[model samples]
Target: MVSDTLKAVMQKEGVVAIVAQGKAFPHVVNTWHSYVSVGNDSFIVPVGGMHGMEEALNHDNRVLVTVGSKEVEGLHGMGTGFLLSGHAKMISDGEEYALMKKNYPWARAIMNITILNAIQTV
Candidate 1:
Protein backbone atom coordinates (compact mmCIF):
# COMPACT_ATOMS: atom_id res chain seq x y z
CA MET A 1 0.00 0.00 0.00
CA VAL A 2 1.13 3.55 -0.73
CA SER A 3 0.52 6.38 1.66
CA ASP A 4 -0.81 9.72 0.55
CA THR A 5 2.58 11.28 1.24
CA LEU A 6 4.41 8.57 -0.67
CA LYS A 7 2.01 8.82 -3.55
CA ALA A 8 2.60 12.52 -3.67
CA VAL A 9 6.32 11.89 -3.75
CA MET A 10 5.90 9.46 -6.60
CA GLN A 11 3.95 12.04 -8.53
CA LYS A 12 6.85 14.41 -8.22
CA GLU A 13 9.72 11.95 -8.64
CA GLY A 14 9.06 8.67 -10.39
CA VAL A 15 10.92 6.77 -13.05
CA VAL A 16 9.75 3.56 -14.67
CA ALA A 17 12.50 1.16 -15.72
CA ILE A 18 11.85 -2.02 -17.64
CA VAL A 19 14.17 -5.01 -17.66
CA ALA A 20 13.77 -8.04 -19.85
CA GLN A 21 15.75 -11.24 -19.88
CA GLY A 22 16.59 -11.94 -23.47
CA LYS A 23 17.57 -15.18 -25.06
CA ALA A 24 21.25 -14.39 -24.86
CA PHE A 25 21.41 -11.73 -22.17
CA PRO A 26 19.42 -9.39 -19.96
CA HIS A 27 18.56 -5.94 -21.27
CA VAL A 28 17.20 -2.90 -19.48
CA VAL A 29 15.19 0.10 -20.69
CA ASN A 30 13.91 3.10 -18.76
CA THR A 31 11.90 6.27 -19.21
CA TRP A 32 10.32 9.07 -17.21
CA HIS A 33 6.59 9.69 -17.36
CA SER A 34 3.62 10.86 -15.39
CA TYR A 35 1.94 8.17 -13.27
CA VAL A 36 -1.48 8.19 -11.68
CA SER A 37 -3.32 5.98 -9.24
CA VAL A 38 -6.11 4.03 -10.80
CA GLY A 39 -7.28 2.08 -7.75
CA ASN A 40 -6.74 1.80 -4.06
CA ASP A 41 -3.56 -0.17 -4.54
CA SER A 42 -2.94 0.00 -8.24
CA PHE A 43 -1.21 2.46 -10.52
CA ILE A 44 -1.24 2.88 -14.27
CA VAL A 45 1.85 3.83 -16.24
CA PRO A 46 1.72 4.25 -19.98
CA VAL A 47 4.55 2.59 -21.86
CA GLY A 48 5.26 3.57 -25.45
CA GLY A 49 6.24 1.43 -28.44
CA MET A 50 3.78 -1.28 -29.41
CA HIS A 51 5.54 -3.32 -32.08
CA GLY A 52 9.14 -2.28 -31.91
CA MET A 53 9.52 -3.18 -28.24
CA GLU A 54 7.62 -6.43 -28.48
CA GLU A 55 10.76 -8.48 -28.19
CA ALA A 56 11.75 -6.84 -24.93
CA LEU A 57 8.36 -7.42 -23.34
CA ASN A 58 8.13 -11.01 -24.51
CA HIS A 59 11.52 -11.90 -23.10
CA ASP A 60 10.84 -10.56 -19.59
CA ASN A 61 8.23 -8.60 -17.71
CA ARG A 62 10.00 -7.87 -14.43
CA VAL A 63 10.22 -4.15 -13.72
CA LEU A 64 11.80 -1.94 -11.07
CA VAL A 65 10.31 1.41 -10.15
CA THR A 66 11.80 4.10 -7.92
CA VAL A 67 10.16 7.23 -6.56
CA GLY A 68 11.55 10.09 -4.49
CA SER A 69 12.41 13.76 -4.41
CA LYS A 70 15.26 15.99 -3.31
CA GLU A 71 15.60 17.30 0.26
CA VAL A 72 14.59 20.78 1.21
CA GLU A 73 15.69 22.91 4.11
CA GLY A 74 16.61 20.87 7.19
CA LEU A 75 14.00 18.23 6.69
CA HIS A 76 15.17 14.64 6.43
CA GLY A 77 14.27 13.35 3.03
CA MET A 78 14.23 9.80 1.71
CA GLY A 79 13.18 8.02 -1.41
CA THR A 80 10.81 5.06 -1.72
CA GLY A 81 11.34 1.98 -3.86
CA PHE A 82 8.76 -0.24 -5.43
CA LEU A 83 9.16 -3.59 -7.15
CA LEU A 84 6.40 -4.10 -9.67
CA SER A 85 5.42 -7.65 -10.65
CA GLY A 86 3.31 -7.56 -13.76
CA HIS A 87 3.66 -8.70 -17.34
CA ALA A 88 3.70 -6.25 -20.18
CA LYS A 89 0.84 -6.86 -22.55
CA MET A 90 0.15 -4.88 -25.69
CA ILE A 91 -3.00 -2.83 -25.57
CA SER A 92 -5.25 -4.78 -27.89
CA ASP A 93 -8.63 -3.49 -26.78
CA GLY A 94 -9.44 -0.65 -29.13
CA GLU A 95 -11.34 1.55 -26.72
CA GLU A 96 -8.83 1.17 -23.91
CA TYR A 97 -5.91 1.48 -26.25
CA ALA A 98 -7.43 4.51 -27.83
CA LEU A 99 -7.71 6.22 -24.47
CA MET A 100 -4.08 5.54 -23.70
CA LYS A 101 -3.07 6.54 -27.18
CA LYS A 102 -4.93 9.80 -26.85
CA ASN A 103 -2.87 10.81 -23.84
CA TYR A 104 0.47 10.08 -25.48
CA PRO A 105 0.58 11.53 -28.95
CA TRP A 106 4.33 11.23 -29.36
CA ALA A 107 4.34 7.51 -28.65
CA ARG A 108 3.95 5.12 -31.53
CA ALA A 109 1.94 2.91 -29.20
CA ILE A 110 1.24 2.52 -25.50
CA MET A 111 0.92 -0.29 -22.96
CA ASN A 112 -0.93 -0.01 -19.67
CA ILE A 113 0.94 -1.32 -16.63
CA THR A 114 -0.85 -2.79 -13.63
CA ILE A 115 1.24 -2.58 -10.51
CA LEU A 116 1.36 -5.85 -8.53
CA ASN A 117 3.62 -5.01 -5.65
CA ALA A 118 4.95 -1.96 -3.89
CA ILE A 119 7.54 -1.79 -1.10
CA GLN A 120 9.06 1.03 0.84
CA THR A 121 12.83 1.55 0.69
CA VAL A 122 15.01 1.84 3.76
Candidate 2:
Protein backbone atom coordinates (compact mmCIF):
# COMPACT_ATOMS: atom_id res chain seq x y z
CA MET A 1 0.00 0.00 0.00
CA VAL A 2 1.06 3.62 -0.56
CA SER A 3 1.52 6.03 2.33
CA ASP A 4 0.83 9.77 2.34
CA THR A 5 4.50 10.71 2.64
CA LEU A 6 5.47 8.27 -0.05
CA LYS A 7 2.84 9.73 -2.32
CA ALA A 8 4.34 13.14 -1.68
CA VAL A 9 7.73 11.80 -2.68
CA MET A 10 6.27 10.42 -5.89
CA GLN A 11 4.93 13.82 -6.80
CA LYS A 12 8.39 15.35 -6.64
CA GLU A 13 11.13 14.94 -9.20
CA GLY A 14 13.38 11.98 -8.43
CA VAL A 15 14.92 8.80 -9.72
CA VAL A 16 13.14 5.48 -9.66
CA ALA A 17 14.97 2.24 -10.32
CA ILE A 18 13.18 -0.88 -11.40
CA VAL A 19 15.20 -4.05 -10.80
CA ALA A 20 14.31 -7.29 -12.50
CA GLN A 21 15.81 -10.76 -12.75
CA GLY A 22 17.52 -12.03 -15.84
CA LYS A 23 19.13 -15.28 -16.90
CA ALA A 24 22.64 -14.11 -16.06
CA PHE A 25 22.59 -10.84 -14.21
CA PRO A 26 19.97 -8.69 -12.60
CA HIS A 27 18.61 -6.07 -14.98
CA VAL A 28 17.95 -2.54 -13.85
CA VAL A 29 16.03 0.25 -15.53
CA ASN A 30 15.51 3.86 -14.57
CA THR A 31 12.40 5.99 -14.67
CA TRP A 32 11.41 9.24 -13.04
CA HIS A 33 9.26 9.41 -9.92
CA SER A 34 6.81 11.58 -11.82
CA TYR A 35 6.26 8.76 -14.31
CA VAL A 36 4.64 6.56 -11.71
CA SER A 37 0.94 6.53 -10.96
CA VAL A 38 0.18 5.08 -7.54
CA GLY A 39 -2.88 3.25 -6.34
CA ASN A 40 -3.74 1.56 -3.06
CA ASP A 41 -1.85 -1.66 -3.83
CA SER A 42 -0.74 -1.06 -7.38
CA PHE A 43 1.39 1.21 -9.54
CA ILE A 44 1.01 1.84 -13.24
CA VAL A 45 3.94 2.96 -15.35
CA PRO A 46 3.64 4.38 -18.82
CA VAL A 47 6.46 2.53 -20.47
CA GLY A 48 8.12 4.68 -23.06
CA GLY A 49 10.79 2.06 -23.34
CA MET A 50 12.46 -0.61 -21.23
CA HIS A 51 14.51 -2.86 -23.49
CA GLY A 52 14.69 -6.10 -21.53
CA MET A 53 11.54 -5.85 -19.46
CA GLU A 54 9.42 -8.27 -21.40
CA GLU A 55 12.19 -10.83 -21.62
CA ALA A 56 12.91 -10.54 -17.93
CA LEU A 57 9.23 -10.73 -17.04
CA ASN A 58 8.96 -13.87 -19.08
CA HIS A 59 11.50 -15.47 -16.77
CA ASP A 60 10.15 -13.91 -13.59
CA ASN A 61 7.48 -11.31 -13.15
CA ARG A 62 8.70 -10.26 -9.72
CA VAL A 63 10.32 -6.83 -9.57
CA LEU A 64 12.00 -4.51 -7.08
CA VAL A 65 11.58 -0.76 -7.37
CA THR A 66 13.40 1.96 -5.47
CA VAL A 67 11.94 5.46 -5.46
CA GLY A 68 13.19 8.52 -3.65
CA SER A 69 13.00 12.27 -3.61
CA LYS A 70 15.39 14.68 -1.92
CA GLU A 71 12.77 17.39 -1.94
CA VAL A 72 10.46 15.50 0.38
CA GLU A 73 10.92 15.48 4.12
CA GLY A 74 12.24 12.23 5.48
CA LEU A 75 12.52 10.62 8.88
CA HIS A 76 15.85 12.29 9.53
CA GLY A 77 16.32 14.90 6.85
CA MET A 78 15.08 16.31 3.56
CA GLY A 79 15.12 13.04 1.60
CA THR A 80 12.62 10.19 1.63
CA GLY A 81 12.58 6.79 -0.08
CA PHE A 82 10.84 3.46 -0.33
CA LEU A 83 11.77 0.02 -1.59
CA LEU A 84 8.86 -1.68 -3.26
CA SER A 85 8.46 -5.34 -4.16
CA GLY A 86 5.86 -6.35 -6.70
CA HIS A 87 4.82 -8.48 -9.63
CA ALA A 88 4.89 -6.77 -13.01
CA LYS A 89 3.33 -7.31 -16.39
CA MET A 90 3.56 -5.42 -19.65
CA ILE A 91 0.39 -4.69 -21.56
CA SER A 92 0.10 -2.92 -24.87
CA ASP A 93 -3.65 -2.61 -25.00
CA GLY A 94 -6.26 -2.36 -22.30
CA GLU A 95 -7.99 0.20 -20.13
CA GLU A 96 -4.82 0.63 -18.13
CA TYR A 97 -2.71 1.13 -21.22
CA ALA A 98 -5.26 3.53 -22.62
CA LEU A 99 -5.17 5.55 -19.43
CA MET A 100 -1.39 5.64 -19.44
CA LYS A 101 -1.29 6.56 -23.12
CA LYS A 102 -3.46 9.54 -22.34
CA ASN A 103 -0.72 10.84 -20.07
CA TYR A 104 2.34 9.68 -22.02
CA PRO A 105 1.63 9.74 -25.70
CA TRP A 106 5.06 8.29 -26.37
CA ALA A 107 4.47 5.18 -24.29
CA ARG A 108 4.60 1.87 -26.13
CA ALA A 109 3.24 -0.20 -23.28
CA ILE A 110 2.13 -0.20 -19.68
CA MET A 111 3.82 -1.89 -16.80
CA ASN A 112 1.24 -2.68 -14.20
CA ILE A 113 2.84 -3.59 -10.91
CA THR A 114 0.92 -5.14 -8.09
CA ILE A 115 2.63 -4.38 -4.83
CA LEU A 116 3.54 -7.26 -2.56
CA ASN A 117 5.49 -5.26 -0.04
CA ALA A 118 6.58 -1.70 0.46
CA ILE A 119 9.22 -0.57 2.97
CA GLN A 120 10.25 2.93 3.89
CA THR A 121 13.97 3.21 4.45
CA VAL A 122 14.23 6.94 4.93
Candidate 3:
Protein backbone atom coordinates (compact mmCIF):
# COMPACT_ATOMS: atom_id res chain seq x y z
CA MET A 1 0.00 0.00 0.00
CA VAL A 2 1.05 3.62 -0.53
CA SER A 3 1.20 6.22 2.19
CA ASP A 4 -0.53 9.61 2.11
CA THR A 5 2.75 11.47 2.25
CA LEU A 6 4.07 9.62 -0.77
CA LYS A 7 0.89 10.37 -2.67
CA ALA A 8 1.16 14.05 -1.84
CA VAL A 9 4.71 14.18 -3.16
CA MET A 10 3.62 12.50 -6.36
CA GLN A 11 0.95 15.11 -7.04
CA LYS A 12 3.40 17.97 -6.96
CA GLU A 13 5.48 19.20 -9.86
CA GLY A 14 8.55 17.07 -10.51
CA VAL A 15 10.19 14.62 -12.85
CA VAL A 16 9.37 10.93 -12.79
CA ALA A 17 11.96 8.51 -14.04
CA ILE A 18 11.12 4.96 -14.92
CA VAL A 19 13.92 2.40 -15.24
CA ALA A 20 13.21 -0.68 -17.28
CA GLN A 21 15.30 -3.82 -17.53
CA GLY A 22 16.99 -3.89 -20.89
CA LYS A 23 18.95 -6.54 -22.71
CA ALA A 24 22.34 -4.82 -22.55
CA PHE A 25 21.77 -2.13 -19.97
CA PRO A 26 18.94 -0.59 -18.00
CA HIS A 27 16.79 1.70 -20.09
CA VAL A 28 15.49 4.83 -18.46
CA VAL A 29 12.64 7.12 -19.50
CA ASN A 30 11.26 10.35 -18.11
CA THR A 31 7.74 11.52 -17.60
CA TRP A 32 6.20 14.32 -15.57
CA HIS A 33 4.00 14.33 -12.48
CA SER A 34 1.20 15.82 -14.59
CA TYR A 35 1.20 12.78 -16.85
CA VAL A 36 0.32 10.32 -14.13
CA SER A 37 -2.91 9.19 -12.51
CA VAL A 38 -2.51 7.57 -9.11
CA GLY A 39 -4.52 4.79 -7.59
CA ASN A 40 -4.39 3.26 -4.14
CA ASP A 41 -1.24 1.29 -4.98
CA SER A 42 -0.72 1.89 -8.65
CA PHE A 43 -0.04 4.48 -11.35
CA ILE A 44 -1.33 4.99 -14.85
CA VAL A 45 1.13 6.74 -17.15
CA PRO A 46 0.33 7.93 -20.63
CA VAL A 47 2.78 6.58 -23.19
CA GLY A 48 3.82 8.80 -26.05
CA GLY A 49 7.18 7.80 -27.55
CA MET A 50 8.65 5.41 -25.04
CA HIS A 51 9.58 2.80 -27.60
CA GLY A 52 12.68 1.80 -25.71
CA MET A 53 10.70 1.32 -22.51
CA GLU A 54 8.09 -0.65 -24.36
CA GLU A 55 10.74 -2.89 -25.90
CA ALA A 56 12.36 -3.53 -22.56
CA LEU A 57 9.02 -4.43 -21.05
CA ASN A 58 8.63 -7.06 -23.71
CA HIS A 59 11.39 -8.99 -21.98
CA ASP A 60 10.80 -7.97 -18.36
CA ASN A 61 8.02 -5.88 -16.91
CA ARG A 62 9.69 -5.01 -13.65
CA VAL A 63 10.47 -1.29 -13.23
CA LEU A 64 11.94 1.16 -10.76
CA VAL A 65 10.10 4.49 -10.68
CA THR A 66 11.83 7.46 -9.10
CA VAL A 67 9.75 10.45 -8.10
CA GLY A 68 10.49 13.54 -6.04
CA SER A 69 8.99 16.78 -4.88
CA LYS A 70 10.66 19.86 -3.48
CA GLU A 71 7.38 21.00 -1.96
CA VAL A 72 7.19 18.09 0.45
CA GLU A 73 9.29 17.72 3.57
CA GLY A 74 11.82 14.95 3.75
CA LEU A 75 13.27 13.26 6.82
CA HIS A 76 15.94 15.94 7.16
CA GLY A 77 15.03 18.55 4.59
CA MET A 78 12.23 20.29 2.68
CA GLY A 79 12.38 17.94 -0.30
CA THR A 80 11.76 14.24 -0.69
CA GLY A 81 12.08 11.42 -3.19
CA PHE A 82 10.95 7.85 -3.45
CA LEU A 83 12.18 4.79 -5.23
CA LEU A 84 9.25 2.64 -6.24
CA SER A 85 9.55 -0.99 -7.22
CA GLY A 86 6.67 -2.16 -9.34
CA HIS A 87 5.44 -4.34 -12.14
CA ALA A 88 4.40 -2.62 -15.38
CA LYS A 89 2.51 -3.57 -18.50
CA MET A 90 1.58 -1.57 -21.57
CA ILE A 91 -2.10 -1.34 -22.21
CA SER A 92 -3.58 -0.18 -25.50
CA ASP A 93 -7.20 -0.75 -24.72
CA GLY A 94 -9.58 -0.76 -21.79
CA GLU A 95 -11.08 1.83 -19.44
CA GLU A 96 -7.73 3.04 -18.17
CA TYR A 97 -6.44 3.49 -21.70
CA ALA A 98 -9.55 5.44 -22.60
CA LEU A 99 -9.07 7.82 -19.70
CA MET A 100 -5.44 8.46 -20.57
CA LYS A 101 -6.19 8.96 -24.25
CA LYS A 102 -8.90 11.45 -23.43
CA ASN A 103 -6.44 13.57 -21.55
CA TYR A 104 -3.42 12.91 -23.76
CA PRO A 105 -4.59 12.79 -27.31
CA TRP A 106 -1.13 11.91 -28.59
CA ALA A 107 -0.78 8.88 -26.34
CA ARG A 108 -0.54 5.57 -28.14
CA ALA A 109 -0.75 3.40 -25.07
CA ILE A 110 -0.73 3.44 -21.28
CA MET A 111 1.82 2.04 -18.89
CA ASN A 112 0.01 0.48 -15.95
CA ILE A 113 2.18 0.05 -12.88
CA THR A 114 1.32 -1.92 -9.77
CA ILE A 115 3.48 -0.75 -6.90
CA LEU A 116 5.11 -3.41 -4.73
CA ASN A 117 7.37 -1.31 -2.55
CA ALA A 118 8.03 2.38 -1.98
CA ILE A 119 10.96 3.81 -0.03
CA GLN A 120 11.42 7.43 0.91
CA THR A 121 14.85 8.88 0.19
CA VAL A 122 16.33 12.31 0.33
Candidate 4:
Protein backbone atom coordinates (compact mmCIF):
# COMPACT_ATOMS: atom_id res chain seq x y z
CA MET A 1 0.00 0.00 0.00
CA VAL A 2 1.09 3.56 -0.63
CA SER A 3 1.72 5.46 2.53
CA ASP A 4 -0.30 8.61 3.09
CA THR A 5 2.87 10.72 2.93
CA LEU A 6 4.05 9.23 -0.33
CA LYS A 7 0.60 9.42 -1.84
CA ALA A 8 0.31 13.01 -0.81
CA VAL A 9 3.68 13.84 -2.32
CA MET A 10 2.72 12.03 -5.51
CA GLN A 11 -0.49 13.97 -5.64
CA LYS A 12 1.44 17.17 -5.19
CA GLU A 13 3.91 16.13 -7.84
CA GLY A 14 2.06 14.31 -10.57
CA VAL A 15 5.09 13.36 -12.63
CA VAL A 16 7.55 10.55 -11.88
CA ALA A 17 10.18 8.34 -13.44
CA ILE A 18 9.73 4.69 -14.39
CA VAL A 19 13.17 3.18 -14.34
CA ALA A 20 13.62 -0.30 -15.75
CA GLN A 21 16.68 -2.45 -15.63
CA GLY A 22 18.75 -2.34 -18.79
CA LYS A 23 21.73 -4.34 -19.97
CA ALA A 24 24.30 -1.63 -19.39
CA PHE A 25 22.42 0.79 -17.18
CA PRO A 26 18.96 1.63 -15.96
CA HIS A 27 16.59 3.11 -18.53
CA VAL A 28 14.58 5.99 -17.15
CA VAL A 29 11.41 7.43 -18.62
CA ASN A 30 9.59 10.39 -17.19
CA THR A 31 5.82 10.31 -17.37
CA TRP A 32 2.65 11.67 -15.94
CA HIS A 33 0.78 9.15 -13.83
CA SER A 34 -2.28 8.36 -11.81
CA TYR A 35 -1.82 6.45 -8.58
CA VAL A 36 -4.08 3.49 -7.77
CA SER A 37 -4.38 1.18 -4.82
CA VAL A 38 -5.18 -2.44 -5.56
CA GLY A 39 -5.03 -3.50 -1.91
CA ASN A 40 -2.70 -3.44 1.07
CA ASP A 41 0.92 -3.36 -0.06
CA SER A 42 -0.35 -3.53 -3.63
CA PHE A 43 -0.03 -0.06 -5.11
CA ILE A 44 -0.27 0.61 -8.80
CA VAL A 45 0.89 3.53 -10.94
CA PRO A 46 -0.18 3.85 -14.54
CA VAL A 47 2.29 5.49 -16.90
CA GLY A 48 2.33 6.49 -20.55
CA GLY A 49 5.41 6.31 -22.69
CA MET A 50 6.70 5.47 -26.09
CA HIS A 51 8.46 2.21 -27.07
CA GLY A 52 11.24 2.47 -24.51
CA MET A 53 8.94 1.90 -21.55
CA GLU A 54 7.35 -1.19 -23.08
CA GLU A 55 10.63 -2.54 -24.36
CA ALA A 56 12.29 -2.05 -21.00
CA LEU A 57 9.50 -3.88 -19.20
CA ASN A 58 9.83 -6.75 -21.64
CA HIS A 59 13.47 -7.13 -20.67
CA ASP A 60 12.87 -6.92 -16.93
CA ASN A 61 9.73 -6.69 -14.85
CA ARG A 62 11.60 -5.10 -11.96
CA VAL A 63 11.46 -1.31 -12.00
CA LEU A 64 12.13 1.75 -9.88
CA VAL A 65 10.28 5.05 -9.74
CA THR A 66 11.47 8.40 -8.45
CA VAL A 67 8.90 10.99 -7.56
CA GLY A 68 8.40 14.33 -5.71
CA SER A 69 9.49 17.86 -6.58
CA LYS A 70 12.68 19.75 -7.13
CA GLU A 71 11.16 23.20 -6.92
CA VAL A 72 9.52 22.74 -3.56
CA GLU A 73 11.68 23.80 -0.64
CA GLY A 74 11.74 21.89 2.60
CA LEU A 75 12.44 22.99 6.16
CA HIS A 76 16.12 23.43 5.41
CA GLY A 77 15.67 24.38 1.76
CA MET A 78 16.19 20.82 0.60
CA GLY A 79 14.42 19.38 -2.42
CA THR A 80 11.57 17.00 -1.82
CA GLY A 81 11.75 13.66 -3.57
CA PHE A 82 10.82 10.03 -3.27
CA LEU A 83 12.00 6.75 -4.66
CA LEU A 84 9.67 3.85 -5.34
CA SER A 85 11.04 0.47 -6.29
CA GLY A 86 8.91 -2.44 -7.43
CA HIS A 87 7.78 -4.80 -10.16
CA ALA A 88 5.41 -3.81 -12.91
CA LYS A 89 3.19 -5.65 -15.32
CA MET A 90 2.47 -4.23 -18.72
CA ILE A 91 -1.25 -3.95 -19.27
CA SER A 92 -2.98 -3.36 -22.56
CA ASP A 93 -6.34 -4.59 -21.40
CA GLY A 94 -8.70 -4.41 -18.41
CA GLU A 95 -10.06 -1.42 -16.52
CA GLU A 96 -6.64 -0.04 -15.63
CA TYR A 97 -5.58 -0.11 -19.26
CA ALA A 98 -8.82 1.41 -20.33
CA LEU A 99 -8.49 4.12 -17.76
CA MET A 100 -4.95 4.84 -18.81
CA LYS A 101 -5.96 4.97 -22.44
CA LYS A 102 -8.78 7.30 -21.59
CA ASN A 103 -6.43 9.53 -19.67
CA TYR A 104 -3.62 9.42 -22.18
CA PRO A 105 -5.04 8.84 -25.62
CA TRP A 106 -1.73 9.06 -27.43
CA ALA A 107 0.06 6.65 -25.14
CA ARG A 108 1.69 3.75 -26.91
CA ALA A 109 1.37 1.49 -23.88
CA ILE A 110 0.24 1.63 -20.27
CA MET A 111 2.38 0.14 -17.53
CA ASN A 112 0.86 -0.81 -14.21
CA ILE A 113 3.72 -0.68 -11.73
CA THR A 114 3.17 -2.43 -8.41
CA ILE A 115 5.17 -0.46 -5.87
CA LEU A 116 7.22 -2.62 -3.50
CA ASN A 117 9.01 0.15 -1.67
CA ALA A 118 8.25 3.81 -1.27
CA ILE A 119 10.68 6.25 0.33
CA GLN A 120 10.04 9.94 0.50
CA THR A 121 11.80 13.02 1.84
CA VAL A 122 9.56 16.01 1.66
Give all TM-scores, in the order shown.
0.66, 0.94, 0.97, 0.74
Q: Give the deviation of candidate 1 from the true structure as CA RMSD.
A: 3.7
For residues 31-98, could you state the per-residue lDDT of candidate 1 as single tens digits? Answer: 66364434455555455543434576676665445554442111234544445555555455477656
TM-score of 2: 0.94
52 Cα displacement, candidate 3 (Å):
0.9
RMSD of each: 3.7, 1.1, 0.8, 3.4
lDDT of 2 at 101: 95
Candidate 3 lDDT over residue span 3-29, tens digit each: 887888987989999999999999999
Clashing pairs in 1: none
lDDT of each: 0.54, 0.89, 0.93, 0.65
Q: Write the per-residue lDDT of candidate 2 for residues 9-116, one digit (tens) a residue.
A: 889988889889987889898888788898998888888778687789889999999998888889999998999999999999988899889989999998988989
Q: How big is the positional error of residue 44 in model 1, measured in Å on the Cα after superposition?
A: 3.4
Which segments of model 4 are wrong by more than 4 Å? 33-48, 70-79
Give me the overall lDDT of model 1.
0.54
What is candidate 4's local distance difference test score?
0.65
Native-referenced Cα lDDT, model 2: 0.89
Clashes of each: 0, 0, 0, 1
Candidate 1 lDDT trough over 10 residues, lowest sum: 68-77
Flag the better candidate by TM-score, 2 or 3: 3
